[model samples]
Target chain A: MPRWFYQLASPRWCYQITGKLLPGFAIAALLLIAVGTVWGLAFAPPDYQQGNSFRIIYLHVPTAYMAQSIYMTMAIAGAVGLIWKMKMADMVLKCCAPIGAWLAVLALATGAIWGKPTWGSWWVWDARLTSMLILLFLYLGVIALNSAIESESTAAQATAVLVLVGLVNIPIIKYSVDWWNTLHQPATFKVTEKPAMPVEMWMPLLLMVIGFYAFFAVALMLRLRNEILRRERRAGWVRELLQQQRG
Target chain B: MNNKATNACHLPELKSGEISFQPGRIFWATLVRELNLALRRRSDLINPLVFFLMVATLFPLGVSPEPSVLSTLAPGVVWVAALLATLLSLDSLFRSDFDDGSLEQMLLSPQPLFVVVLGKVLAHWLLTGLPLTLMAPLLAVMLFLPAEGMWGLMLSLLLGTPTLSLIGAIGAALTVGLRKGGVLLSLLVLPLYIPVLIFGTAAVEAAVTGLPLGGFLALLGALLAAGLALSPLAIAAGLRISVSG
Candidate 1:
C-alpha cells in the first residue's frame, strides 16, 4: 500500500488530514449549493407541465443522489474495514449511517413536496420513491445495529456484515419493487425520466449533485473526526492533541 | 481438573482425538442437533405458528370480515403474517446456542462455519418456515383466499420462507449477543425481507388473478437461490463477530 493509504489507518493522520480538508469541502458545498439552488429555482426555465413546482428537483435529485451514494460509500467503507481491519474505515462507516439516513429523508420529503404538484399526492408509492424509503430503513437498520451492541468494534464488524448484506440485496429489492410497482400501477409518468432536460435546468442539477457530494464529504469528515477522537481517546496522540487544543 | 481429565478419558479414542474436515457430518450434526433441541422445546416450535395463525386472524377481524374483502386481502395478509412469524422466531435461532456456549464451540470446531450455519438455517426452516407454509393454507381458507390461489400461496411460502429464515439468521446471529434483540432483529431484518415479501405476494396475487405464475415463482426461486448461496457467509461472519466480540 501507498504511504498515504497506510497513514489513513492511523487515527492521528486521519484526523489531521480531515481537519485540513474539511474547510475546502465546507466552502465548496456551501457556495455550490447556494448558487445551484438560486440558479435552479429562478434562472432555469420552468417545466412546461409542472411550472415552478419542478424546482423541488434541485433539492430532490441531489439529496436522492446523495442518499444512494452515501449508502454505497458506507457499504464500501464497511467492506474496507472488514477486509483490512482498518479502524478509520470503520469510523467512516459508522459516521455515514445518520448522514445517509437524513439525506434519504430529505429526498423523500422533497419528493413528497414535489409529488403534490406532479403526481397530485404527497406519496405515490412510485418504485423509485418506495426503494428510496427502503434505503432509508436500511440506513436506520445499520444505525440501530451499531448502537445496540455495547462494544464498538464488535458493533462495527456486525454492521459491516449487515451493510454488505444490504448492498447485495439493494439491487434485488429495487428490481422487485420496480416490478411490483409496474405490475400494480403500470407506468405513472416517472418524473425524473423526462426527455433530456434543457442545459439551463440540467446544469444546475449537475452542480447541485456535485455540491451534495461535497457537502457529504464535509459531513462525513466532521463526523469521522469526532468518531476518531472518541474511539481513540485513550491513545497517546489523542491525549496530546487534546492537550494541544486546550492550550 | 481431575474430573475433567477423567471425563475426557471416558470418551472413545477416535471421538476424543480425531479432528477431521467432515463438512457433511458437521452439517448434519448441527442440523440434527438444532432439530432435536427445537423438538424438545415444543413451545418454540408452536409459538410462531400460533402467532402466524393469530396474525392472519387479525386481518379478517381488523379489516372487513366479508368474504370478498378478505379474499382480496388474503395473499398479502398471509404473506405478511408468515414474514412476521419467521422474524418472531428468528431471535431464538442462535440465542440459546450463544448462551449455552455451543456457538463458541461451533466457531472453534475444525469444520467450516458455513456448513454449520447452513445446517442451522435449514433446521430453522424445517421447524418454523416449513410449518408456516403448511399452516398457511388453513389461514388462507379462513381469510377466504380462492382455491386457485392456494397452490400459489403454499408454493410461494415454500420457496420464500426458507430465504426468510436464511436472511433472518444473519440478523439473529448479529444480534445474538444483545439482550433485546427481538425488536432490533426485526428492524434489521425486515427491510431485507421486502424483496421476498414482494415476490412471494406477487406470486400468489398472480395466481389469484389467473395470470401466468411462472415469472413470479421463478423470481421467488431466484431469490431463494441467492439467499442460499450468499446468506451463510453473512450468517457465519455475524456469528463470529457476535461470539467473539
Candidate 2:
C-alpha cells in the first residue's frame, strides 16, 4: 500500500496533494465533458420514438446517475468516518452533500423539462420522479442536520447517523417502480438488454457518463482542498500556504 | 477498622450499579419522568392537540363541504394534518430539557443512555404521537371518513405514529439546540417521513375500498419495528452531540 494514501488522511497532506491534482483533473474534465456534450447533442441519431428531445438524456442521465452515486459515496464516507473516526472521511461526507443535492436538483429539473414534451405534463407522482424527489429531500435533510448544530464535529456525527438511517430508502427508491405497477417506464439502461441504439448514440452516452465522473472528481478535489484550508486555517502550515499563495 | 470501611464502600457501589442497571425499572422510570415533565407543561400537551383540530377544520374551508367530497378527501387530509401536528409537537421534544439542564442530568445518570433516550422517545410518542392516533377517529368523523375505514385508520395510526415519533426524535435531537428550531425540525423530519405517509395513507385508503388491510398493516408494522430498533440509536447519538456541542 502506498504510504501517501494513509498520509493523505492528514488534512495537510490532502491539501497539498489535491492542489497538485486539481488543475490536471479540471482540464481533463472540461475537455471530456465538452466533447461528450457536443457529440451527444449534435451527432448522435435522434430516437425513433422520442425524437430530438431525447438529447436531453446527455445531461439528465449523467446527473441522475451521479445523484445516486454521490449519495452512496456519502453513506460510505459516513460509515468510514463513524467506524474509523477518520477526519478526512467526515470531510468527504460533508463535501458530498451539497454537490449531491445540486446534482439531484439538476436531474429533477432536466427530467421535468424533458417530460413536458414527452409525457405531456411537467410533473407527475410517478415512482421515478417521486423517488428522485425523495432522494433530494434526503440530501436536504442531511445538509439541514449538518447546519443546525453549532459544533462542526457534532454536526458531522449527527448527519452521519441520519445518513445511515436514511440509507434504507435508497434501495426502495431504486426499486419502487420495478416492484410496483407504475406509470413510470421501467429502467432503460440495462446492461443485459440488447442495445436499442446504434453505437453512435450509446458511445456518446458512455462518454458523457465518464465525463460526468471526471467532473465530479475535479469538483470534489477543489471543494476538499478548500475545506482543508478553512479547517486548518489556524495551523502554521495553512498560514504559510496562504502567504505563499499571496506571494 | 479498615475491613469495615472497605466492606461498606464496596456494598454501596455494588448496590448502586445493580439498581441502576435494572433495565425494566430504568426504562419505565425514565418513561414516567418524561411523561411527567410533558404533562406538567400544560401548553405542550394542549398545543399539538389543538393544532390537530385546527388543521382538520381547515380542510372543510379549503374544499367543498359536500359529504361525498369530504369523505373522499378525509383520510388523506386527516393523515397529512396529523403528520404536520406531529411535526409541531416534535419541536419541543428535546428543546426544553436541553435548556433547563434536565438533559445533562439525564446524560449523567447511571442508567444506559439509550434506554433513557428510548424512554424520552416513548414519552414523546405518548404526548404527541399517541394523541394524534387517538384523535384520528374524531377528526375522521369531522372530515367524513367512511365508517368502514375507521378501524383500519385507527390501526394504521396506532402502528404508524410511533414510527413517526421515533424518526422525528432524531431530527428533534439534532435541532434541539438551534434557535427557532420548529421550522427546521419539520424540514429535517418531513422528508424522512415519506414512507410512513405512503403506507399510513395507503392503509386507510385500502380499508375504504374494502381491500385487504393485511398487507398495508404488515408494512406499517415492519416500519415501526425498523424505526423502533434503529431510531433510538440515532437519537442517542444525536442527543450526545446536541448536548455536548
Candidate 3:
C-alpha cells in the first residue's frame, strides 16, 4: 500500500482530522451565509425586470450549484471506492446522498417560488428546473438503491456503478432537456448568464455560493464522521473511543 | 433447462478455463435457453403487448376521445406507453436465472460475461421491444395518429427500444439478487431512459409537424450503439456485485 493511501484510508485518522476541521467550516458557513443573505436581500439593487422576486436567486443559484457539485463529488468518491477499494470512499458516497438531495429540493423550491413571480406560474417546463427536477429523482434513486441492498460492500459497488452511469447521462439529459424546452417554449432566465451584472449584485451571489459550499463541507464531515463511527464500531480504536466517551 | 447447468458441470472438458475463443457457441446457447424459457411462459412474452394496448386505450378514456385531440397527442402517447411497457417487462430479465442458479454458472464460465449478457438482452429485446414496435402502428391508428407519422413512430420505437433493453439490463442485473427489487429497478433505471425517450418521441413529433426527423432517428441510433458498447459490461459488473454480495 502507498504511504499516503494507508493514512487516508484510516477511519480513526479521518474521524480525528474531521473533528479538528469541522469548526472552521461551520464558522465560515455561518458568517458567509449570514453576511451574503443580508447584503443580497436588503442592499443589492432589485432586478430591473423581475424586481424583488429575483432575490431568491441568492438561495436558488447557490443550492443548485451545490446540488450538482455534491453529486459529482459522490460520483468521484464512488469511483474511488470501486477502483481502490477504499472503504472511506463508500462512507463518503453514502453520506453525501441525503445532503445532495436536500440541496436539490431547496433549489427546486426556490426556483418554483421564483418562477411564480416571473413566469406567472409555480411550475413551467423550464429546462433548468426540469433538469434539476430530474436530478432530484436521480438522487432519490441512488438513496433508494443504497437502502434496498443489505450488504455494505455490495450496496457500495452497485451504487458506484449507478452513479457513474448517472455521471455519463447528466450531460446528455441536460442537453436533451434544453433542446426539448427550446422546441416547446422560449428560453427563460439563466442566473449565471446576465447582461454583465454590476459587481454589487454578483459579489454577494458569489459569497452565498461559497457559503453554501462551506456549509456542505461541514454537513458532509458530520455525516462522514457518524458513518465512520457506526461502521467501525467493532474496531479496537472505536471501542476505546466509545469507552472514553461513556466515561 | 435447469438441469443443463448441472449436466454441463459433469463434463470434464468444460471444466478447463480455456474453452477456446468460441463466443458464438456460448451466445447461441444462452439466447436459445432464454427463448425456450420465454416460450414456456408465453404470458410473459405477450403481457407487455397487452399492457401496451390497454394503456393506449386508457388515454382515450382519461382524455378527450375526440379525434383532433387524440391525433395531436398520439405521438407522445404511443411513445410513453411503449417506454412503460418495456419497463414492466424488465423485471423478469434476470430474476428467473438468478433464482434457478444458472446465472451463477454463467458467471463461473470462462466464456466472456458480456457476450452472454448480450444474448440475454437480445432475447429480451426480440420479445418485448420488437413486439411493441410492431404493435405501435395499430395503436397509432387507434389513436387517430396522422397517416404521415406512423412510419416515424414505428421506426423510432424499433430503434429506441433495444437501447431501452440494453440500458434496463444493467438495472435488472443489479437488483436481481434482492427479494423485492421491481419498483426499485424502475427507480434506478427510469432516469437513464430519459434520453432515449426524448429522442424517440421527438422523431415522431417531428414527423407530425412535417419537419425532418432523420436527425432524431440518427441520435437514437447513436444511443443504441453506445448502449451496445457500454451496457453489457456495466450489467456484468453489477451482476457480479449483486451475486457475490
Using Cα atoms with residue i matched to residue i, what is each candidate's TM-score against the true structure?
0.94, 0.92, 0.94
Ranked by DockQ from best down, the candidates are 3, 1, 2
Please list the residue runs of candidate 3 whose C-alpha ends up more than 4 Å from where it truly belongs after superposition: A173-195, B1-18
Candidate 3 lDDT, A149-170, residue by residue in tens: 9999999999999998888766
- Residue A107 local lDDT, model 2: 94
- Candidate 1 residue lDDT tens string, B74-176: 9999999999999999998988778767678779877799998999899999998999999999999999999999999999999999999999999999999
Better of 2 and 3 by TM-score: 3
Q: Lowest lDDT 10-mer window, candidate 2 chain A?
A: A179-188
Please name the candidate that would achieve the greatest lDDT relative to the true structure: 3
Candidate 3 chain A — worst ten consecutive residues by lDDT sum?
Answer: A180-189
Q: Is the docking of candidate 3 incorrect, acceptable, medium or high quality?
A: high
The model with the greater DockQ, 1 or 3, is 3
Best by DockQ: 3
Candidate 1: pairs in clash = none
Residue A214, model 1: lDDT of: 97
Query: TM-score, chain A, per candidate?
Result: 0.91, 0.95, 0.91
